[model samples]
Target: MNPTRSTFGLIFFTKKANENGECRIYSRITINGKSVDLSTKRIVDKILWNSAKGMARGTSKESLEVNDYLEQFRSGVVDAYQEAIIQQKPLTPENIRNAFLGQDEAAHPFQDLFNYHNEHEKQVLAKGTMKNYYTTQDYILQFLKKSKKPAEWDISQLSYKFIADFELFLRTFKKKDDPQPLNNNGVMKHLERFKKMINMAVTIEWLDKDPFVKHKLKFNSKERGYLSEEELALVETKELKTDKLMYVRDLFLFGCYTGLSYIDAINLTANNLMIGIDKEHWLITQRQKSAKPVKLPLLPVAAELITKHRHDPRAISNGTIFRPISNQKLNDYLKDLARECGIDKNFSFHLARHTFATTVTLANGVPIETVSKMLGHTKISTTQIYAKVVERKVSEDMQALRSKLSRKTVPDGEMIILK
Candidate 1:
């Protein structure tokens, strides 16, 4: 017996038509020709529903509303069919209908899938990534609470419209101590994480249809900021009066040379360094972000910094090259350091990774594939963002072309044709 085989239809209950000539629409679910009728509780005009197409016929508001309800009803029925098979229940039309209608005690329409992810996926996911997921969950709770409709946030009531509303809410939501709401990419990230959790539900047969299926995540392209070669040298060599400022500057410079994010850089222990294929020193660690293995030969400057701190009491005691520091405090010191050095941009600690990809590597003619590996990127496309922003690379290419075409200069306003 093919338990997966099933058919569904919609019909207008003309006999239940009210005085206004509007009839109730009912769902007909069939399993091996054994059928069951369930009331949809949606009223529509007598002639609006197209029985053959299993949908409403026209563009009127009532017809559109009826069509949306019918689609959700069908999705729930599909969910019911999967649930029935999973629990080894008898594959009867009535059993499926009961599950769809919440008459089955086993069916849970609003299972907390976000909570499920935290409990299960946390084991495999990095601690930093798990923290981001928790942030997404908190934002979702805020969205649901602000909706003020008890029924609206339920799993069964979710639709494309609901997704749109949630995105809007995230964009405009400003929590305490936050000066502004989430920017475009910030909003997209929350939705992307939420989509992953929703996918878990679909896999477990909790949701038959994904609301995010029709939604495409769009992140606006912004040119990443990186320090120039001169700026990096200035920051690296600057003498700070305070030990804390000096400490933050060195940590930031280490990231610039190695392309490790803030978390990966601080968590690095002495064991991460090893002899490479060339029999020279290399940094060997997996990126906490992508969990990709990073095996990059140490640059001279990076190796020098490691040697400079090799004998520090804190480094020896902690077994880490650099002890952990608060990200906020580091960024705070970095702002002062950048001002003192007369170099300016958004001087956050994470800017060091961008600096490594641009001025320290690509601008110096390093291969992009090699740079991608050093950075522990899963995709080369991510590293290409840095390459595009390297204006020096574009200028160098143009300069090489200028040298090749040195024979003659085109006269002013003279038209040149390609042969």
Candidate 2:
């Protein structure tokens, strides 16, 4: 009694007849003693059906045509079952029905699944992520049109060739909004979105195999720049003329201490601040981007900034721990601040996050694992990216080793020589 052993046959519903006294035909699939019925969309009069034979009583033209159609439908169902067996797919009635109806993911159109995935994900994904998914969809549509392919593609057609061609199109094709084509990582993001939809198809058994199995997504790692301690000190000490610039600077420094992104920083409230196990002030909040919890003990500088803003009328009225500022204006003021402070680098709010990871934490003797937790990183590997930027730490480590070796009477007995 192997569960995969399936039996299928065509049957007519003689009890349920229409006004014309015709009963609808159905195909029944049985697997592991379980059964399911699928409509064949064909009908015949009760008098013409032969229950024992499981077909219409035949001889006349109409009867012969009905019998022939039934035979063909039965053959298709049997073929589907045989194919499932050959492929070693789970032999389920629903799977067989999908196969017989040509609705298995291999025969199913890609657009349908893509749309379904997008619609389902809208409830759970962040707004920015949903925008990326939409953009990826648009890119796919554009590729199909440029290649003169059909609006609908079968799930089976999502081969390595298809992925390669789509990636090439993304690299070379220019959209109306921008003249430059997508960079490597940007292209990979779209492919990743496409892969997500395909995975969903596989999860539901709509697709028998993953087309992206052999295709590996490649990304170029760009240098993530952050302000050094000296540069940060300069920015902190600089006196700016405008109140707006001062406000932006304070907010930027707050991020540098807490490693919060602009969205997370602006969304913070008094409720998010809590006493930790050490009875010290802590920012206990969830990251807006990934909704992961972040528990960071407030450093002296970060605490001072929070106290400065605690009594601000705007913050009190807005019910936010800090007064809100648009990200664009913040970045614009950071650029001006960089020039005024003599820091020669592109300055943005996100750089504050990078600075926190490198200068504020790692270089200051904090473990990367602890820094990752404070930063609300779901993976330590993400925090490792910042670890690479701690060249000062590397130098200090080597220098400390050199100092220890120099102090040691390395064996007043033996002299070492370089190769």
Candidate 3:
């Protein structure tokens, strides 16, 4: 039989009659010419079947009601099916809004970005890195709250203007307890993390574009002030006798001599030193920063310092070789040492590293390339700052050239002829 004319109505027809003494009725539903098998178990099913059958015969008021109900039910099923089938597809605006308003699983926009970073960083990075990530997120949440935006706002909505404005917003916004400017570097540091977060988004194809592509990142300025040789001499020669103070001094001087960074020097001991084929003391150690192994020829001065303070049984242990002191306490003692020596500059333990890089190496005419290796700088440009000290060498060479060019042509009162 032909289906009903109504667009939304269901039509039912017999499938086949059984071979029993009573003819068996077969029921099938047709809606808009498409067939659906109908089960006659429930009252709702029976009513729907009867309405479809009635419509097939002639459209009735009751059949129209059934058609309306069928249309609604069919729509609900189709929607549920679409959601199930297209679960992996990129979300449309309507889908996201429905999820947000309906408080469904699709509500969280940043969920993917968050999950990705959590897995990526949780394994490879350190505890400190994880801590920083949360801190950065805290600021982001604060910004979202102030802007009345969803916590899971679209990652792509982070436009250039939005980010620049947020930076300005951070500069003025104060915490409840304090009325002070937010640390600019702290803000930038966190925002830098956002760049990384979005980079991951780009990799996963979540974001079509990068927001940080053209943005110029402001780098935190380095504290470049370092102690001079005379200042170091004053710190060393001035008498200071507390066991801890003495240890700090010796450690600082050792760094200055060997160009070992604080952590590298901390790890060095009798084991790191080896007598090489040239019969000179050499240090074979891996740099703490880059983990690159380096073979350094120890200077006579470095050897002398080591011999003078050969790791005492009290100080040396199975762990680090140098006398261990907290960075805070070491810096404090160095500050006091600096004051006693009448040196006005701030005296951090790292200045010892700077002193080595600048005064000890450059002043002694050791090539910057060699100094860079000793200082364990991964880039030559990093070592080029000391190139400024070599300007005097250029001046001296020019002076010698000038002297040669101006030398009198006559020697022993005899005129010299040009060749």
Candidate 4:
């Protein structure tokens, strides 16, 4: 088959030199200035590569083998192009690349990306994180159905418009139980997970270009809500009307006292408790999300809750000190409990950790570094966010300021009159 092409193919080294002092080899197929790149999944030494010849230099075994592979790669592109012409397909770089990879007849389902990531990162990612990914994939399926897009799309089919549409869908979509649609940061989070899987596809040579390269993720900076000491005390002391509300309140309180996230709280078992250096019972465990070690001395209130729930049949069955209800249901119960306790703000279980960081720990003279460790944060800067927002200007401090303002000191040159 005779076809006009700009260049048969160009074998090149990736721009980023390897930290191990090697460079990965890649190929660019161009047809009439339209091009697509395919990673060779091969490498050569940085010092031995000859950029001008697009081959490894010298008579060494590695150089000879690399050069031979380059020749085969160039021929492969030509053969792929010929096959496409015989199949009566237009001569485009993407068409040739798909033919070369034998992927022309097959395409990766965008849905399968979730499975691909789960299979590879199951050990590295937390189960809660994997669950979130599953939700994102489900949302993507819903997005496709709503937009009347095909279930199957080529990796190259992902585009800026697709991302924008997904964002809009997330904004307008509401969960079955919730009255509100996804918040701004919630939309950004789903998109972030989606981008992560896309990046993996690019890494494995499934896609040539990143669709999100031009897309900007804009997450709103909002103050994280937390219960104050009085509010926490109110929730703790107020007798709930029902067991359902009591269970959720206990779980929320446990999280508040321990700085344990919802996932971490559910994963806590009898083994997570240990006697610390102070000879007091401590909740010794690791943060599930970050896997950072945590050793916190159980406060009296936290210890009391553990003892109160120690004989809980469900807790025993689940092999944990406490078992919370489902996340959505838990948040719903918290909303009801907030109103029952005469608190104005709607509460979520996650805000329990925020309360722990700000009101329970930092407000009560707990050092920030120690709080960071208990929260399983890796950086001091991350913990500092809680510090900046804590309601430290209490009534007493305000009263003291008022007293100082009342006692006006007259300047040497002028007398100030009280209004």
Name the better of 2 and 3 by TM-score.
Answer: 2
Which scores better on lDDT, 1 or 4? 4
Each candidate structure's TM-score, on Cα atoms with residue i matched to residue i, is 0.73, 0.72, 0.61, 0.85
Worst 10 residues of 3 by lDDT: 1-10
Residue 306, model 4, lDDT: 93
Candidate 3 — which residues are off by over 4 angstroms?
1-156, 173-194, 204-206, 220-223, 308-310, 385-419
C-alpha RMSD of each candidate structure in angstroms:
13.2, 12.6, 17.6, 3.9
Clashes of 4: 0
**lDDT tens digits, residues 34-76, model 4?**
5677788789888998888778899999999988888888888
List the candidate 2 regions with Cα displacement exceeding 4 Å: 1-74, 77-99, 102-111, 409-419
Candidates' lDDT values, in order?
0.79, 0.83, 0.63, 0.82
Better of 2 and 3 by lDDT: 2
How would the candidate models be sorted by TM-score, starting from the highest?
Answer: 4, 1, 2, 3
> What ranges in model 4 sit over 4 Å off?
1-11, 104-106, 122-127, 144-149, 172-181, 386-388, 393-419
Of 1 and 3, the candidate ahead on TM-score is 1
